[model samples]
Target: MLLMNEKIKASEVALTGLRGEDLGIVGREEALAMAREAKVDLVCTSLLSSPPPCKLVARGAAKQTDAQEKKAERIQGGAVKTKELRLTAHIEEHDYETKLRQAEKLLTSGHAVQLTVKLAGAKEGERAKALIDRMLKELAPHGTRETGIQVSGKQAAVKVNPA
Candidate 1:
């Protein structure tokens, strides 16, 4: 989840989204108090900001408006945007099937899935490669990779699109 804070305080100087660096330690009420003390409304700058939280301030009549904005955002992003599913090198059949089912659900809705694999050592690397290979095969039968598998240290990611 991400919090957005847009300072729309024209009547007064608002400091919106002041909880980016200090996220997780503050709540809406706390944020509101922080904004109110600062004389502004808490507006979300980037609700889905990779870090998962952001806030700002503006002096306006947007009290608890963050609720509405967040709700709307949740509905939109939650239902529409891409979703990811994770699998380890030694993932079992039932677990793989489950995650695949979930990924298929998202893909059927025109959403992308980022298949991520985590590895440990050389032995784990071989297992990771094997798991990734099998996943690619399964996905190939039903989907295609828009982005090829990429490795970032011990993790590999590929963007899959439904066929």
Candidate 2:
């Protein structure tokens, strides 16, 4: 949590410089007074130090710093993209292998894969179900199946998320 002037509880707190180097421990009231006199805020920076730690900085400076840190983390961990691969009930073995390879590639690159097997009629729906089962088996090592095989209308689809 980002600590502020009033949230600080220690009667005495170690003061910190602008670069976060420790200055020394001082009475909390004096620190508050110094911040007030300097027309800035007194912020609690570290809670595990000997007397806890505080810093005097301009108002909103701590909040801005916190926001920047969070933004950096979000950017470091990129967003997950979802890629789809489609197949038919009577797909050739070579085409099935190609679809599996594409799905594996997407999963290895930290993307989710949506596998879809379209059925032309009720008669072909059972064959589509078998195809989906084979796909799940082949792709298990690359990703985890997030949902069970679901058949809606003429489509049987499953979602696989990166492991």
Candidate 3:
């Protein structure tokens, strides 16, 4: 929460001008007087600081600035996009080619690709591994494998990233 003007309880504060110029330290009363003189609000920026930092901001500009900062943080903290492509050990040649083209397209467009192969019988694990290896080899020009093939019970998977 932000404390403005008379609501600020600190006796003294490190002040900044409306244009963000440092104004050093001043008594809360003096800061409020300055704010009043400049037709702006004295808003406490950081309450945890030694003397609490306050700035002179236009009436609604403080809230607007805070909202913009939050929006920027949300955009910067967004996660990378990832695409998943599932395959079968007994896939036909044409279907395999189609999947390879899709993976290539996804990788070239900057999306991380998770390649997964489903296994049926115990002996099918080798075929699944072979299939995954073949796909990785085909995709080598477009992407690099981020994780080595992982086989768990009836599935094998790998992560690939754009080169």
Ranking by lDDT: 3, 2, 1
- Whole-structure CA lDDT of model 2: 0.84
* Tens digit of per-residue lDDT, candidate 2, span 23-117: 78898888888888877888887777769878888778889998777655644688777888989999999998999999988887778898988
Better of 1 and 2 by TM-score: 2
Each model's Cα RMSD? 15.2, 12.6, 11.5
**Off by more than 4 A, model 2:** 1-78
lDDT of each: 0.62, 0.84, 0.89
| Stronger candidate by TM-score (2 vs 3) | 2
Model 1 Cα lDDT, one tens digit per residue, 45-137: 543343223355455544556556754564566544567888887888999898878877776655778888887654676667667677778
State TM-scores per candidate.
0.46, 0.53, 0.52
Q: Per-residue lDDT for 1-163 in model 3, tens only?
A: 7688999999999999988899999999999999999899999988788799999999889888887776456446666478999998899999999999999999876678999998887788889989999999999998899898998898999999876
Better model by TM-score: candidate 1 vs candidate 3: 3
